[model samples]
Target: MDRPRRIAGEVWVAVGVLAMAGWTLTEPAHPAGFITWAAAILVALGTAAQAVTGSLRWWGGRLCGGVVGLELVGAVGDRFGAFGRPGSPAVSWGDWSHFQAEAAQLVPWDRLVVPAAVAATVAEVVLGVLLVVGPWQRWTGKATAGLFVIYLLAMIPGMGSASILEYGLPVLIGGALVSSARGDRRATHQSPAVGRENTLAADYK
Candidate 1:
């Protein structure tokens, strides 16, 4: 992406982080929700930092990915009654069952909710670590792109317009990262070809 667009995307991501924080703070009783939002904020801030400073882009990408992985873990934990407190209605088997039904309606299959959720959550954590700490970043970017697609599709049926409004840009941002990473790989591959052509020209001269 061009510099201006990159900066704009970063700003949007930062704004989303702040918005999620503001929304979460209004419900102080929901600690699990707060934690998830905090992770999302970290991701947004990290990605924004990438746009702000080119030298730290790798760090920023890793930070965002790491936090996103945490968010996924928190989501999985929340599903299993891990976030419940004594007087709070945080854990509800009934609600979870209902959610399963909803998810089934959106994307129906055998063992849809548990299996899909578990798989996606695990993948998110793994991909996040790879993005942050591993050398295979282009693959990481592709994995992230696929994960975002799944998330967007899964949420849209239930969340409707609100989900789209909140998440659409993130999906776009993911796509941008995938495209840019792929472009970098292509450029790297072409370097040797360019070098060979340069040597051939020098010989002719």
Candidate 2:
């Protein structure tokens, strides 16, 4: 089950990278578009890092966590830089506000959208770090899963079917990561017992 989930996660990450490539090809020839392109690539890298390092937990966590940390930083930059609008001269609070406003339309929390977005951003950075340096696997994995679920839901509205489809693969990858996290933690817990059994068999031989 763990192997299958890891494989699926890898495939999903590859699909996400390809989808972002296609988006790059089709997007309007504008500078601001690069921000979205870069963000997608960073996310794909993080997903792939988690998928590939099935055995090396520490390094895997670092790779995945670092990329996500960078991603959150980029997102914060987008908020202030107006998502790098071509003509904007300074921080574009308007762009950030517009984004949360659209999300407000879908959920019944109009007043909470801004606060939620802010909290999510901060959570992303903190959780990403904890995933890297902490021993709390289940907790970090659950938090990451919750964050991606919010992202998936917020994406459904104001996007075309194709765009939505492109985004869906990442959600699947995130789910796979969550499963892998649990599986890995269990494996870690059982490894010492397995080692002891092997040692006993060798002694008997």
Candidate 3:
């Protein structure tokens, strides 16, 4: 955590989004919902500021680490009552089952999910490894950017504004790495090239 501020900001923003969702679900509570919503807004705003100012790259390692951490924590939570049972996840259990059933009805067994699921899962795991190991940040950055696009595609099929709000933000954030790449390139290109020392000639003589 080279930059503790960035990690705090990013984590806070994620939490803030959660808080906002919770607040909205229980709208117009006598008084306290307003406070929760306000706090959410502040956290997200702070994260955005840090992200845009180039002060949060320290969280690069944390970003990769977070991918695994969140998944581990989620898997563990679901094992208990924290996330409800297998057939029904606590939050959107009904919708989840409905979607699966609908997809099953429409898709044929032989022609269905195996290929895509395997390919995508493999890619995800490989990308996660690359991200964690810091093997090639450029390649990883580009891949992450592509994953962001894939997420947007996921949202598009749903045809919901809420989906866009919930998922598209990550795509925007992924663009941060792309932006960093371009900035690095520009800085490299602008620096004076090889041994061309053209100092002022003999003015003091």
Measured on C-alpha atoms, candidate 3 has an lDDT of 0.39
Query: Which candidate has the top score in lDDT?
Result: 2
Which residue pairs in model 3 clash with each other?
A: none
User: Which residues of candidate 3, in runs, are more than 4 Å off?
Assistant: 1-56, 59-112, 167-205
Global fold similarity of model 3 (TM-score): 0.43
Candidate 2, 1-205: lDDT as tens digits: 3345445555655766666566556764422244444545554555555555334432443454444445445545656553566345432233666546545654566678778777876886676566545445445555665676566666667444344444343633443353334343333335666744543332112
- Model 3, 1-205: lDDT tens digits are 1134234335534743664465446654422333233433433443454354233432433343334323323323333435554466232223334434433333347466445434544565565565444444445545654654554455555443344343323423333242223222122223333211211110111
Q: Rate the local accuracy (lDDT) of all candidates.
A: 0.49, 0.50, 0.39
Please provide, for model 1 over 85-175, each residue's C-alpha lDDT reduced to its tens digit, 9 standing for 90 to 100.
3234533222345445545655667667677755765785676555544445545555666666666676767556344333333623443
Worst 10 residues of 2 by lDDT: 196-205
Considering lDDT, which of the candidate structures 2 and 3 is the better prediction for this target? 2
Cα shift from native, residue 119, model 3 (Å): 1.4
Ranked by TM-score, top first: 2, 1, 3
